[model samples]
Target: MYRYDQYDHLIVRERIAQYRDQVARRLNDELTEEEFLPLRLQNGLYMQRHAYMLRIAVPYGLLSSAQMRMFAHIARKYDRGYGHFTTRQNIQFNWIELEQTPDILADLASVEMHAIQTSGNCIRNITTDEFAGVAADEIMDPRPFAEILRQWSTFHPEFIALPRKFKVAINGAVEDRAAIAIHDIGLTLTHNEAGEAGFKFMAGGGMGRTPIIGSVIRDFLPWQHLLTYTEAVMRVYNSYGRRDNKYKARIKILLKALGVEEFARLVEEEWQDLKDGPETLTREEYDRVAAYFAAPAYAALDNIDPLAAHADSKPFANWLQRNVKPHKVPGYAAVVLSLKKTGVPPGDATAEQIDFVADLADKFSFGELRVTHEQNLVLADVKQADLFEVWTLAKSKGLATPNIGLLTDIISCPGGDFCSLANAKSIPIAAAIAERFDNLDFQHDIGDIELNISGCINACGHHHVGSIGVLGVDKDGSEWYQVSIGGAQGNDSAIGKIIGPSFSGGQMPEVIDRLLQVYVRNRVEGERFVETAQRLGIAPFKEHVYATPISKGELVGEDHA
Candidate 1:
């Protein structure tokens, strides 16, 4: 895990002091709501339906035990005694008081964390794969580059007010766990013919009103020019991006207006002046950042043979099948601690659960953990010998929910329940689906289905990429969920297509049941839900979902597709 130096420490402390005064002025009526909107948003504060919400950045999803403990303390002392982790690899406190936010930020600053750049029309937190360093298929560790970007983007004067909020994601692994194709700018670390490290740049990928898969701008960029080239792209976007309409402000919309060839040419032309300037990365600087993420002291497995022998237990086997993933290190594994229990909202953790995980990280994972974009936590370097013990402790705490890629492992946003922008509630829909698919055996039989729900088309839940995507809509002041099929995330990412009519909140569970049943009846053995849907198209599922009502008064016949 990366620690803050004096420079990092100074920046956050000064920002906290500044925001503290700003909050005081607002409370005293020295600032009106309109006057204080941008000021508060700059500090990651948002006015939600019930109260203010604060989002705290978790840089590249990495956390140390100390930082985890800080989050626990924040949840216990600030807002409610829980925090919701988000798909962007950040955490949100829903019941915040405007007056208390400065103190919360100050506490966060104490632990080398801050909420700066988590909101606002600025470059947000740079994210990467959760299994960056220890993944078996990684080309390189991306956190060093992500950290470099974080340092470069935080409070960068040039991007303070962009056309809209921007995001950047990097993927170093063969698997695209970061969902790079849907970010404002996406980078994939790769090697050139000379075997030297560089990047493949993708630009204008986003998922709001218009979901787009980013286009390849540069097939290969030398490592030294990484920052300079990025600056060039930012300059191009900041120059021509639409500012009049918020809907058309994202770089993706801009890219659509200007073709990829012209956009790439513009970026290349801008890169001429900045390519080898002060921003060109040096080997020493890269090494400095990379050294921080080097492997920790892992023990030899031969020393713990006794514990490793006990992995055959039924519970341990089930957990091992779902929770544990292969590690690059010989005797270690990456353990996923699921946050998607049946009753709990996806990606939420209570204060006690936070503390418990913090302790577990210290005990089993070299005091470090990583948050996944899929709303789960990863003990990235847990020794194989400790797997059984970790499983036992986790199961007791309601954290061991052997359903990582199953239907019940849903991804959802805090919809009408917390966000003012939401058109309908998302939590109840997620809970209902989870309850309906509570059978783990059944879920495993179905296999690798992603179900994502968003309160609105803003797509905060990444609903655009789910195998079964659910979007809440405001239809005549009532909540309606429109379903989409065949959406996917990762290297082969694709936005789902609308299947048929929108369903009332009451019909969502039954609709999902019919879709799954259709899938089971038509799918070949060993095929995942997305593969089956793609193979058979959405017709079979659509037919089953929109079939004549089993009962007289059913609303399934409605046609609002």
Candidate 2:
């Protein structure tokens, strides 16, 4: 819930005005699509398969109730009446008109939001954990640092163009909810032996043609030098990162070619000029930014009695156990609004649901909301005593699917339905899997599982992170999905191992059922799917899935059918 200062306000307003004129010029045919490509991309506009998609930056995934309401307004006014929340913790409006875009940008500016850095090959939105301010295990709130980076990168002359799209993620918590390890630059706040805060600077991570996990470039970059050090990295990348081939353009690719030692030497040389520059965090700037994200007021209440009583009385006790996260404050509970309902696409919240979330944020969580890296919205500080009341309101809004962090809490892309690059419909695949695992009691007992579906190999859905990753590809124009297993997000992030031959759309759900059956049958009594699969490898599951069951046609014994 960071507030905009006068300077911040002016820059956003000016950007909107600038983009508005540019949009007008494009419509007037003064600028061709080729000429306007970079211009529109700078403002987060993209010409996707079916329509123009506008991605609006939600810095660090935090949203004020008012700002979120503005998203609802935009969704209702332009394009379809819904927006897709993405893995990068931003929202996308597909089916946008060329002309109405500027008006939408103006409206977003009014609410202190913008489309800048949401597209193009420059520094993108700086993402952190959704529970930064309220998580029980946080070392410190990450938003102040995120905001500082925003100012440093936004419209900065030097970084206006880069070799490729750059991403940065920061994490200050024990659990790496921000997926920091897989970003272009990852910063984790940690304490040194001297008991002072600094960042564990990770470099060279990205996903695309070549996926990589970042290596530790600087073991402990002092907190005061955070911005200056970051600028050093960007400088090193801009000066030497590849521009020859788009495929080999990311900082990660450069780092891979140069080797970590040589890259670190280059960064060290660059950092010498910026150890005490203007972008370095001063006490005044730190205090000013930190003031905006000071923790919310909470009334002390006993959670033990009320939560125990509710747990005993409620049918959603299983849900309460899986979806609800612990809050830093004693009596507050961080509630996740699950979009992963049975027979519905995961992470696809309707426009009505957006408004409801805004309302609930205003009423229940101090007028603040957060979108999770897992593609869900969160009321970060709901009182434990009001869990039932919050659940009731959420149920009416169709946000009461109790599958957060479970197998059904799948991550997916628009697939063939919305993506031009997609060969298959991913949403339907997500729905079919969710429907297969609809039983709450079963899910609770089954434990945590991740299912990621992408329409293509572009991996927009982060299929590399899912426990069972499904990637759609075309085999002679028929939609086929390739399966991978044992992928994980968080601290030990790893890309999944591919199983075998791909399956058609109709065979997708059946394949998933077979995979789950293998997990269920082979697992130790209390073992989770991820653990069991990791322990036993994908061979067992692969064999079961490819096996022709009783439901499938078989050859006759005497004569071939």
- Best-fitting candidate, scored by lDDT: 1
Off by over 4 Å in 2: 311-314, 549-561
**Model 2: which ten-residue window has the lowest total lDDT?**
552-561
TM for every model, in the order presented, reads 0.97, 0.95
* Alpha-carbon lDDT, every model: 0.89, 0.84
lDDT of 2 by residue, 149-229 (tens): 988899888997999889999998999999887899999999999998989999998766576878999999998999888
- lDDT by residue (496-558, candidate 1, tens digit) is 989987888878888888989988898888888898888888888888888766321222221
In candidate 1, stretches whose alpha carbon ends up further than 4 angstroms from where it belongs are 302-312, 550-561
Q: Which candidate number maximizes TM-score?
A: 1
